[model samples]
Target: MKLSSPENQAETAVTSSLQAFLETDIAPKANRLDTDTIALQRALSQLNQFQFLGLRVPKVYGGLEASLLTFRQVQALIPRYSGAFAFLQTQHQSAASLLANSENQVLKERYLPAMAKGETLMGVGFSQLRRTHNPPLTAIPVEGGYQLAGKVPWITGYGYFQYFIIGATLPDGKALYGVVPLIPTPQPEGGNLEFSSPMQLSVMNATNTVAATVENWFLSEEEVLFIKPANAIHDSDKKNVLHHGFYALGCARAGLDILENNAGKKELPFLEESHQTLAQKHQSLSEAMFAALPPTETSFQYRLSLRVKAIHLAQRCAHAAVISSSGAANAQSHPAQRVYREALLFSVSGQTKAVMEASLNTIADYV
Candidate 1:
């Protein structure tokens, strides 16, 4: 991969833009939100207007064509304002990234442009618990293309998204992925689809993760796109995992920013000494963690592990910030409330803390 000189500058620009949005749009509405439904949709629309939704698409498709590193930096910024918005943006980019590997020239030309324009949203359909989330090779030949029958749980942006990239099993049990356009057409007697309320979440209340079921859904051959080897797709998936890892970075930064901005206010005579000690400890710890990441394959795992650790650390920072703020900081009206909620959400992304720990251990063992 070619490292570009503009990557850092791009990251800085994205961060600054997101911070501005958070301060102006998202923060004011966090408390006044109507039903969570209205709040989430509104946030998404605002982000789309800023073209944050197409951060990963190629410039040819009207995207910023940002490097993976740049995208990670942007991801970190989203949670600083709204974790839900960040989560949604991640889903959109993930789908767009998958489209990069697509073979259907027509599909790519059609959808990629629309995605860049923010006229459409894309999501993944690969959360079958029993099976690994590799691409599907299933070619259950049907009249149009194939009958894609499979149960996918935990679709992040279901119901609201227009395009969903689905994974399924070929008759031979190999995995293949299909890009299905989820248009809101007429339904059957009961319903062709069932939408659920947001799963009660510990954090990231704005990200509406919902379970979905698709029965023998018909997909045109164009929808099948390129059913390439799963290993070919793994490389991109790894990049995405790392990029998503930046969410923790943003959360931790937000927590630390809040803490530092109010440090003097936190200085009581008794706690002043402890406050200085905590600040130094966190600073050194963070520096060491950041330094441990060298730009190598091994560093990928290290960075990922650190991101998970950072999520927990950020939560600690938030706790400290609230405590240092003398309890009034925990009020729902305070920005810290939203930041704290996002900190919790950052800790429990689609892959939970335990799962991430296992992945880290696996990566270390492999190395």
Candidate 2:
């Protein structure tokens, strides 16, 4: 319950508690929750009560400000039980990250404590790729503050969250961050927030993705948070490095766990060597990703460069795990199959394989 202290003992305690909860409460019912919204809600409510949702919020707002390393450890462990559940939990932490970075005190005070206590849920709308094919969607300014009128293709956790952080373009065409409430709307099918399922592919089937529209959605002066300075992609990239680092680490650890469990149960040649090599590669990549993200340090585009390398390493590890799993992994019911599928989700963390590849190529050109 102590906040702001980086203690190994606390982390160990949290890990043990979470593992016990997953085993007793989550594992037995994970299958049911995978496609059941109500079950997911019940589990998430448990997570909230345990303060898992507020693990990274600052102590002043009733959060523990848990160390990033501890956060990563928890994320890794959660996927061992269920990747779907783990991702839902991570979204809360991501919300905490947004709260931590925002410059608006009023917004922080109003939402952070409630979010920490799990009385409210938070979602972010920043994944827009403009229909016009702009660099990214921008927030244009309007009367008083700004009007956010764009489409974010994949806003996760749509119906469940009560608040959202939106990115928009100002009138001068400056990119800005804004916050809005997702409540008190007109009646819709018995008054619940309407949600549409995203087109499903492989991993994270139950994440509840939806396309969000904020058409001329106006924000008052109080709701506008920080407008990132131009040419701050370095800082942006650095932050994303940390975020995606944890994500990749979580998926890799899940994959490694599957690999370790299935090791020596087969007659595959060089199995030990394969496992060891993959483990080493994953570890090195994880370290590199962590090393690239220095807390509070801002630079232009360095984060993006590091992210490209880190994701490539993660893809390699995921591929290796699947190939090594071979005949045993072919079954969709197999844990290895699940891990393999989940691993592919890492490549789309920002949602465009083409852009990701292009960015990596651009970085490589300079290197």
Candidate 3:
């Protein structure tokens, strides 16, 4: 896990490159267009030039083939410059991971290399999988393929993503996953596919997130990824919550960085002590979480607990930055205020019922 290790040297190089990009390009305009969807497109194009869209893709497909740990580290650095950028990139990375790990040879051959080379960008539309009420999206077997009919509540990076990986439940109680174009030509009126206007939000409005409805959308066999039983999906999801902690930690680290840079000699000792304490906790929890990869139920529970802790610490650190800056931090453009808003996003991102229950139980013990 050491950054200096030979196995991790490539990760170091990527991180260094991202750091330079953040400082030189992203940070300068991070607060300039919080309400502009076009801003995300520009940032994504810049990221494509750096091969960031392919960070996790296999080397054979022209990607950097970074390890999961390295991917988390790079993700952690992104929110420091722009949380919306990090959020969109996370969706892209998730899609890339799905394509890379799919069992369908044709699906892999058709998309992985294009995705790795930045010629294709895919978004994820699986939030419907978490709904507790009403039936989930269903797939009906048809002559040439399956017909998908249902609604996907939230999909980010809308205009920027050419395609999306959607999930539907089969009648026999299996999950069906496929990649479909976001905007198909010959608009299907009340058929096939349609999307709503972008949602307005208190923050990260630049991401262009939207809701979509698919009415008997046909997904040919070649378009399908892998189908798994419901239980398998549940099992896989439980172990994947740890990477989200890095996003919160990244915002916290950004706040701390701002505080340290602005503090005078007299304020240095107190600020440094606070920074070190949180940094140590973040490092310790990160190590433990990764060590438990492909986690068992016990380890999954532990990871959720640590995730909650990281979220609260991020909020605290961001709040501390606001305090240090006094009245100036009240400005919407202030980095401290931005980090504070970004910290709120971590609570909901990648959230599940199990994670929610665990977070609540942990909070109750202190209350």
Q: Considering every candidate listed, which one attains the maximal lDDT? A: 3
Least accurate 10 contiguous residues by lDDT in model 1: 129-138
Best by TM-score: 3
Model 3 poorest ten-residue lDDT run:
184-193
lDDT of 2 by residue, 210-259 (tens): 76555456577798777765435334543454465456566676666556
C-alpha local distance difference test of each model: 0.63, 0.66, 0.78
**Counted clashes in each candidate structure:** 8, 12, 0
C-alpha TM-scores of all predictions: 0.77, 0.78, 0.90
**Residue 221 of model 1: what lDDT?**
82
**How far in Å is the alpha carbon of 13 misplaced in model 1?**
4.4
Q: Over the stretch 300-336, how does candidate 1's per-residue lDDT look in tens digits?
A: 4655666556656667667766766667786776666
- Clashes by residue pair, model 3: none
Per-model RMSD to reference = 5.3, 5.1, 2.9
